[model samples]
Target: MSTTTGLWLFRRLWKPAEGTPVKAVVVFLHGYGEYIDRYDAAASVFARSGIVFWGFDFEGHGRSDGERGFVTEAGFDAFTDDAEQALRLAARQFPGLPIFVMGHSLGGLVAVRLGARLAKAAEAVDAEAGAPLFGRIKGFLLSAPAIEVDPAVAQPHLVFIARVLGSCMPRIRLGGIPAGDLSNNATVNDHYSRDSMNNTRPFAARFASGVLAATEAVPGIAADFTWPLLGMQDEGDKTTVPGACERFVHTCGSPDAAFKLLRGRKHELFMADGYEDLITGTIMPWIEERCETAEPEAGGAAAAEAGLARDGMSGDRDDEAEPTDVDAVKTTTSEEPVLGAAV
Candidate 1:
């Protein structure tokens, strides 16, 4: 456990098997209303592969200290600040190793923003003293980022009202996310519904509004992404919009980015049945390929261009139009309680 930014964050570090030299470190950011322990299975996969894995509960969720589903001030900024702290912790704990940041759902938004921020910070430092500040970060992996929430849950009228109320009574709690919308896997859904540490409380008005604003800011940030990125989203997901992922992949500035649209998966991809092997077979190889190489491929730009051409998006950099009102969705919170759920 570590305390920072006015909260006590519970952290778990998974090391490689005995005698294995850690080749890289992965800092994981879990989804909203969820905790670190839920990712133990995923973390173990990295551990077995000679990688170090670390994850923490967000300040207001899981074992972390804060008002449930609420950010005291700037919502996205606060979350990113905590994420940066986690990255710094990883750097300090495993110096001289490449670090990869992975985020799922709400955590995905944080990871994407953090990658851009780190790239920008490195650029600034290089310009001044020809040195990089966060040169260790190799890439980012985003799973079903909460760029746009389910439209059914975030009605336009409700969003408008929430924004107004956020400016006034920012602390007022509103309804939370619907559990049924999380995944189609019965076991995973059952576990999520029963987890006590899983926060199903209504979100504070300010927090909800802040998330909406952050989601809207993704396109603007995509133009600054400089690291390798891999984004995966479930086509059948009802928790987040798949089109948002498509837009981000097309507009992202990285020449070494790829997007995978899973046909029948759900919001919580890691929790879905038979996903453990899927992650190991697909996601692990992607991360390993990058980790084994010090620099991005020289043909990354050409490859990205080829991808754009194949998608009929050549020279279409300006296609990042904001989604319509019906598509403007933001995640919500609920107040259901279950025993043995808190991490």
Candidate 2:
């Protein structure tokens, strides 16, 4: 998509299988330094299960335009702009389908902000614009959300310095994500390492700062969240702290919010070993529960117009799907492995 700023964003979409009725529209947001392609298997599973999955590479990640691993100096808004653009795109492509936003790691944090944005839009601002979009968002799915960073890595002094440096040198490289540490599965790690489109370089200063800001602010804003949310994180997830997610779910005012700890798993919940169990055991059922909701009022009339104006985003609709369950889901596990198949 080419945004109003004339930036190109790479996007990917998976439609429901032929002869399958569309049940829902899901917009997935990936974590830092990763792209949409990483979730191909999972997206395919959603499609097979009657979901219309849509996602895009953030401006700096994957095949999208921008500096590698860098959200420019725009900080967090850059990421949210892309996500909101994606929501508008999905709404238009699959009009009237209940919208569900899912995010992993930093993407999880973005989803939180996006969810609050939706609620605020529908209730506080233009109901014509926000309600048409917000009210349609029935639920949210989070995986190892980066709403908080592990205190071990984000020490007070380190965080303070990063925030300071970020203000002055937003593009300076701070750290690099070691792909091998992402998953227990070697193939998954190998694939990630092989993907040149990914941001293998050191993290950008401002991007790091933006993430830290979200960690502190998002949890505090949990009081404003008003949607069904199911969050999962592994105890071994060194990538994101479990306690942070736990605190957010508890602090969140939503009556339907719940947090689950996928014990014995690694950081990459979807790509880790035994991901199938995680899907069938937890993630899918949550998806099934809230996937149904009152349809969007505009039937995506506004979203369709938004889609036509897309400078960012990528691509779903349906009801009474034959139950998009994991047991019956046929996925490309041979290529990599499992939650890579579901969440």
Candidate 3:
């Protein structure tokens, strides 16, 4: 699918199993320097579970048209606007299905803001409008969201210098993330290095500045978040700050929010070893439970309860450790052996 939101953005949808009825729509937001294809494995899981999965390349990444890694127009707003366009497309393609927005890394930051905006919009009365533009959003799923940049990439003086340079040369490429830091699986790392659509090139100065600003602003809006949220982060992740994810989940106003800190996983949790079953054990069940309900207004208690049960909290485990916030839980697991084939 393509949308003409100022610039054309490329998107694709993964339908549910042939004989299955579509129960809900999930809009996936890929991480920075990555594209929609990275989530194909997870999409299949969602599809088989009777949910429609769709995602798009952010303006300058993947198959989308734009200068690589650069937010050429509207600054950071361009990304959020692109997300809205994706939501509109989802609504048009499968009207009335409860929509869930899922984001990873930088996309996670976008999802947080998008979810908050939609939740707020659902409450206002529009005299001339038939329905709110974002009334269908039911929840959010975030994986290692870039609410705060890793310290290695967020040096104050350097970021300040980059911001200054961006003002004059917004399109100048700065530097890109190391592929090794993305995952523990060698095959996944090699695949990312070889994928042409993956933006391995250095980020444009303006794009870096925009991302920094957006990430910094996410925590401030946590008070406004009021939808069911499931956030997962790998403690071993070097690509984004895990502490920030923990803080966001704890502080966010959503009564149904739950955070899981995977012990030996990396930035891309869905692509990590044992991730397939992890989704079956956690994410899939969460979505299915909510989709089965006609109205999600009362979903908070049920979602939280279901999440706790799936994490095996019902029974004691020696590897489990609790975070500072009672709401956030930490579970430690031995690293899963790397697969011989690429994810």
Candidate 4:
């Protein structure tokens, strides 16, 4: 409904139903080279659920007015600070609705760290309150959280350089890998390209540093986060290490965390084929469950059915260790199939 800009900020808003009980606020963090506008459909899904949806284009992404695809170590700290400011603004606008955060791709990493930081901050603000803004977070929905690295894919030397020389060279190109390198589902790429229109590939210093910081901080964040959490992982994602996303859910501070596998989905599960059901059925129900007054048990049977790791893999699978679906993509030479194009 409104746009706002400030020091290192880009935000957009959508109002909830008039006089409707503001169930909760959903703040979406878009991933690398992504803009908030891409979430229009997702936001509508939340609106139908009686939640207000707000999000921003991260620095260097979309129309944020920064060097495209660049981020440095210090820049990440600044980015989080800016994100907090946006949250504060949300508080002012929505008065008392519960708040939740969701992230996709690289954004998931940001949400994890933010949840931790918010938890600590909330602790300090109202130590006696049952659920301060921190614990009050209804839940976090992280789609294809980018954690760990796939051994099969060739590592990008430039990405490595940015991590090392982030301070010196904060601005660089971080895109332009191949389809197989990024995702096993070509349809995902097709949708991404069609929806985004501009396929600029640039990397920034802060992006690398932000990633480094997120990697080290996410586990601690997960360990400390007591709020409910839902993590959805695509079995065929190539950009993000797969098992790592699911592992994040199981290891979170909350024993009641839920993890779901979007059958045959890829990195951007929401963008994959048959994703409508994902948003309307699985995801919406998870969020709705959180809005309820009672904190029900999470994913009792779903987690087990989704194939939880019972061994010492610790979320990392062997390079050659491909499950049937993953291996199908890895071994087959045919053009990668898109899951949700017809939808």
Which candidate comes out best when scored by lDDT?
Answer: 3
Per-residue CA lDDT of candidate 1, range 1-343, in tens? 4444566676766777656656677889988888877776666667776677777788788767888888876566888888898888778766667888999989998887888888887777755452222667778888889876667767899889889988899988887877876764666676677777789888889989988888878888887887877777777788878776756765777766666666555777776654655466557777777778553211111111111122211110111111111111111124322111222
Show where candidate 4 strays beyond 4 Å.
Answer: 1-8, 16-21, 128-132, 151-160, 172-188, 194-199, 294-343
lDDT of each: 0.70, 0.70, 0.71, 0.59
Candidate 1, superposed: residue stretches over 4 Å from native:
1-4, 127-133, 150-156, 293-343
Clash count (model 1, backbone only): 12
Query: TM-score of model 4 relative to the true fold?
Result: 0.73
lDDT of 1 at 136: 71
lDDT of 3 at 5: 45
| Residues 1-343, model 3: lDDT tens digits | 4434466666766676455666787889989888876676667667766677777778888766787888865788778878877887777866678888998988998988887777667667663462534556668888888888767768889899889878998888888888876765667787788877788999899998898888778877898887878888887788888677878877888766667667666787777766766666668777776667643221111111111122211101112222221125322234321111112
Q: What is the C-alpha RMSD, rounded to one decimal, of candidate 1?
A: 14.4
lDDT of 2 by residue, 36-121 (tens): 76776666667666667788778878777788866765677778877998898888767677888999988999999988877666
* Count of clashes, each model: 12, 9, 0, 17
* Ten-residue stretch with the least lDDT total in model 4: 298-307
Could you give the candidate ranking by TM-score, starting with the highest? 3, 2, 1, 4
lDDT of 2: 0.70
Q: Is candidate 1 or candidate 4 better by lDDT?
A: 1
Which tens-of-lDDT digit does each residue in 1-343 have in candidate 4? 2123333445665554554445677778777666776655556556655667777777666555556666434467655665666666666665556677888877777777777777666667665563535545677778887655454432567446657666665565444423333334464465455544233465555566566656766766777775667777877676788788777766777545666665565675654555556666666666766677733221111111011222211111111112222211111124432121211
